[model samples]
Target: MAGRGDHTTVPGQFPAQGLRAVLGGWSGAGTKPRNDDAISGRIPETAYEMQVKGAIACIADGISTGLNSDKAAQISVVQFARDYYSAPESWPVRDCAGRLLNSLNSWLHAQNRSGSPDAEGMVTTFTAAIARSTTLHIVHIGDTRCQRLRAGRLVPLTEDHSARFMGGSESLTRALGAEADIRVDYAQETMAEGDLYILTTDGVHDTLGEAGMRDRLAGLPQESREDLEAASRALCQAALEAGSSDNVSCMLLKILALPSETLPEAHRRLTAQVIPPAMKPGNRIDGWEVLEVMHSSTRSNVYLVRRAGEDGRFVLKAPSQNFAENLQYLEGFTLEQWVGRRITNSQVMKIRPHEDSRFLYYIADFVEGETLRDWMKAHPKPSIAEIIPVLASLISAVRVFHRLGMVHRDLKPENVIIAEDGTAKIIDFGSVQVSGFRDLERGDKEELPEGSLNYIAPEVLTGQGAQPLSDLFSVAAITWEMLAGRVPFDLEERTALPSRPADWAAGDFAALRPDLPPATGEVLSRALAFSPKDRPEVMSEFLGEMRKLQGRAGTRPVFVPLLQRGSRGFWRGWALAATAVAAALAVALVALLP
Candidate 1:
């Protein structure tokens, strides 16, 4: 097998400045050994860049023990990086993963169908580590592991997909080429001097638990001539002693310390990295002027923009450095773009991006209206006549997503913008969950979905799987607040809001305003159901129920529950004095009285 000695470092890790990393791994020359480990690299080409750069290394363990497992693992790691770097800069993480998986699946399946037993049931497990500057992004699957050693203790930084504690039926839960697409577990950790990272095949991990591994690493002194190499040897010896039977491979990494003067320079260097020049003003990016910045967010920046070729205008969204650096955020942003494009209506904002590339900025039709929160505050207690129409519009707006088989996981008043025409436009598909977007077989839930904590559905707050019903629950909460003049959960005396499964059931929107129309009240009760299945199955059902209650009264606005005009009471003595004064005035004005 080729080693790190031959492969280059990743583009982002070059120029060898602060936090230099050295990765060296060896395969034991034991009997029945199969060199199932695959590694890749990229080093700086320019002398100046290399002077201030670091290095990146990745190790993949092909399940050589299984039929053609070695080949399967080898192809996955190699193709992943190749496909990743070759793709356009705008490729979203999910799209990238999906594309890579498709390429791999096609290759693996074709190889399997070629009538060779080795290709028939072929599968492999792998773990990969990407180190750059001062951070490590670890992506892995199966029992192959990545461990972090800080202050002489080895920490398992990567979760074992097959670990029984994490619901791996009996062993490792996931493996490469196990199915059509692979699910990679990703995590990011800061790299510091004196930190040691270890990536290994199951052979090494099976031999030592955390305590046992710590003992072996503890004996080695840092900076010793043989420290790094010896540590790998000790692990192998321990595994052998523990009765390991498979080939043991290990990639040991040591983060070399940096000089004090270099730390500040590195900070300046990283921060000074400039964005590429923007397109010329007249140059259109998806028909929107790349206007000056409006706002910046962790994932992306919002720009106040106008349509280039048309009379329309919108807010153009560009991925932030934070989103661009990480694959996950890029994927989520891509999904938002996808959902927005697929479902275009007056109720939903029109989302347009540069043709085919995920890297391009997107234009969303801007809504010129106040958020529901702002509207409600200006008119403290609005009657049903004033509120029901807004609710109807919101429900009508959200109904489009349901028809598209999508759920707006985050539906709050803040996300609902009431347009000047009274059209309550529902925006922010950023948190939407479409049925096609999920992979149920692996049970991987969407991470940190965008939503307001105050308005999230009870089921969602507890980390339950997001579904259509949860969206309904949130919609109900918003509607309830519309009619009741207050949030259902606000009056409760709790240190913090309940974050448990039971708390969702405890909320009663009806209790906040019992005087609400029976139909409106019933809809709220059903929508805020504890179990997601019990809520309205779709937006149409909720809209139908709302329309029924709205029709019982006239189309005109009414402030029935919100306010009323009262007559002023007259004082008895004041009335008598006023009468006497009126009688005297009446004598003088007799002609006027006649």
Candidate 2:
């Protein structure tokens, strides 16, 4: 075997610190007149597609007994590379592979002829893999094998679809073109950096048992790593030297990196972005012209901007030029855009798609509307009938974020904008907390909660992390403020709301609104429970109780159930009744004894 040290091949680079990789493949006819094994691999160009679909590698081995087996092998390998890339980027890897292979199988099955062993058809063994995120997805048919060489051993990642034949020979019982509707065996395995994936034809694998293969892989040259082409050539050469008379083929892929954004890398990318140049009205930056300063704050400045040649009106939020070094604020600004791009709900604010701008800012649809806080001022002392739908919409919008593993920590009425058409759009995601994104913070100490203190949950003030329950607590607070003109608790600075339901007695909501129902107070009390465990764990549970208000009774009931009135009263009643029964039973027992 020639050493790869003598040759140099350029490696592939991808996003996320250039997810680098090396690939090598080799094929040849051992003793056969013509080779019938084919292989191909691909890496997408864009970061989004690469992260979503990942890279693909495929191998196919044609049946020796079938005519045009060489064509079968070549076509399967070639078409898969083309079709897999052409599939929808939004589809999951499994769905894309299945849909593409199903069409390929249909085409091959259409070419079938005789049902004999030595039949003329385009039947072939097929196996392929996709490496994405931190996983490898493998889909196989027939006998071409996919295996991983890790921890000094070769582990098979596929199973052959062959049955016992006469004299210990094996015949393929399942293949790509064997049936009209094919079943593609699929599985996924977690992957690590430096992991090696090897695809082989039966000729290469059958000649070398698992132990011999492990030895061969271990013997691979390590001095000049990333020599996949040389390793593959060497692997195929070994199988030929081992007395194999069939076509030999091998493909190798060495994982160097997985696509992911680390905290340091994210900081670098963000800091590299251009800070918005200070400009008054009529200044143009990257095809957008500033019209007027919409608003200015210590953190950022919002401007009403216009596209150079388009009629679209947009709101551009630029970080204040002075705060460029504030990584905490920059992180929030970046995350606001990230969340905006991913979530598409009627009640959630939508960011307008824009060309890559050099400034540290993003564009959003200019909603000419008033904040919900302003609306509350106009509709002071709003009735419960008028408040349920709006509150429901708010909770429903928050649920979308939760479904995507996000928490809207700052969900106060001030962040919610109410359009003239009565549509409520939740805006300002800079304070939104993401469970996954937090993992990338690299031990960066969490700053104080940036949420509005008046509507924040009690736990947030006590230095606890915000959760879904805490998020709902804010919504319930807004609900109370909307109906009774104030939240269940006082909103003074440095005053944290009680943490448990038992401690919520200080907030007698009905005292302010004499007409308020006890049921409404109970739900509000449960939602704003001091301990998150006592609060409704899911938004649906809180919404379910609110839904009961829309039943035959237009409002919540004031009647307290016997069981729920108070623990003390129920236990006391039971004790009194038990004493009377005991006295009567004692007199009866005395009469019986006499």
Candidate 3:
């Protein structure tokens, strides 16, 4: 039978009647608590929608080995619940889990691409439960355990994704935010009146085995709130005593019935707003005072700003008025908002605080340095040894995005700014596209074109396709320019820009920059190849190959701009035509006299 706490509702309180749940989870690093991750939020009330019969309960544990495992687990649970609650009620419980996972995948891909410093490749194990009447539906991944405690017996509801369970794959074979495809285990069962459901991370289960768990949980008196709390504490203490050095957390949910005074209050809570408000230029929102407009594009407006009640300043970005007015533009804006708000990566910009606003706004630590374009213009391209770290960091950021199943369609010298400390930041997400996730539930072929014309992947230019490798090609092009100090493609006035797949496929960078190292040039060649399949399929491998050329380094070569004096033949002839024109006019007049 299903436990009573297996109901689904939005996060926070409910409007009517249902179950009560408490959550606890813990993480261990063997000798020290590296990451203790767990979360439990009850919809304080209950409701009866067509597809949903009871409330929803969720528990998540991030695989602690990845960076910021604790944070990953916490955000996954909180954000998933938050999104499920706000979602339209058309989907069944399983469908809801699928959609939520899709959204999480997209966000994780973006976060990975951004190369979140704290948790770039972080993965988590979690289980989410939604109850309809007496039925409980669960979606789970990783080793985090989920079980029902009823009639003084413990019943396991989810399986572990550990190495032992997967034929000695020492690492987690499945986890949230770890890959593009998450393997979720789902099941359903009926609930009992006095049932209790518990979810916990490995730290709690590793120390308190099945028998140990039953002993503590069964002894608790259900009638007394204090006894329940004490029993939960005793279980945690027992894990610590058993030499579990991880952060331990657990959740306990009790299933009961409708209370007369609770229903009305629960109903009112459902309509409350959770998103923050939009901030405009020159307006102070969340203590970041907007100062001067930095730049504006079709998508967002960047501003030079100062922090409130602080000495430091930062850069703020908000979606343009045009973008905010259109629902399509909201995708880019909301993505930035979601990525900026949830990630705690130093490499990523921080989300600006807001109140009940929906548009995107974020504050980036202002880099006091020039862009790669400006730097290359002022000084010769630095040696590969000097360039590796910068390139590596940038590559890592892109990897972060790729892991989340996203492609940043644009990457150029102008988009990468190098701070005084030599840290490279790749910005501008206007052209990013999700591979398997779409807000409108539309087909991939139907999505509109989104990316810069110059740096666009060949397939994207032809409206043929886009993938993670496409973005890698663009990154290679930018890296080439960073070292070569000139774009690989330079078309004369007589020729049109290489806007076609044929142009990109046949064009040779070696012919343009003969001075570039042959090995480096070949790497760039394959990356910018006309077909997406010809490029590096994965970012990590591409980066690994690029690293080989970094320290081998070459001397800076003199660069002739595409528009040099010798190349401006047509303009020079036009500039010297005045005397010739007069002489021609005189001869014509003399001929007319004859």
All candidates' TM-scores?
Answer: 0.45, 0.62, 0.48
On lDDT, who's better, 2 or 3?
2
Per-residue lDDT over 1-594 for candidate 3, one digit per residue giving the tens place of the 0 to 100 score: 011121222233233444433333222333454543656544434343412334556666665566766666767777877677665443356667788887786676567667659658656777777655456677888887778887888989988886654465346678877777766788888677677777776768878888899887775664433444455556766787898776665655555542222334433332232222344567776666777778776666778888656667788776655543344445555555555554445454456555554334666667666776787777565555666777777777676656555666767677777777777666656556655333222232234445445566667665666777778777777777667776555433324556655666534545554554557777777787887777777777777877787655344566877566464677678667977898899999999994
Per-residue error (Å), model 1, residue 324? 26
> Model 2 off-target regions past 4 Å?
1-16, 24-41, 47-193, 199-209, 218-251, 257-268, 277-292, 341-347, 353-358, 395-409, 431-449, 453-474, 488-514, 524-544, 551-594
Tell me, by lDDT, which candidate is best.
2
lDDT for residue 521 in candidate 1, whole number 0-100: 64
In model 2, the Cα lDDT at residue 388 comes to 71
Residue range 1-594, candidate 2, lDDT tens digits: 111111223223344444444566777777888777887776667765665567777888888877877777778888987887775443456766788889888877877754544435688999998887677889999999999988787899999999997768888988888789888999999888878888888989999877766787786763233467677777778888999888888777677786566667766877998888666789888878899987887777888899867777888888887778777778888778878887787778788667776667788878779988898999897667777777777887788787766778888887888877777788788877776444234356465566667677777666687788888888888888887887666656535555554655537776776565557778888888877898888887888887675442325456877777668978899989999999999999999994
TM-score-sorted candidate list, best first: 2, 3, 1
TM accuracy, model 3: 0.48
lDDT of 3: 0.62
Candidate 1 Cα deviation (angstroms), residue 34 = 6.5
Q: Distance from true position, residue 422, model 2, in Å?
A: 1.6
Among the numbered candidates, top TM-score falls to 2
Output the lDDT of residue 377, model 2.
94
TM-score winner between 2 and 3, please give it: 2
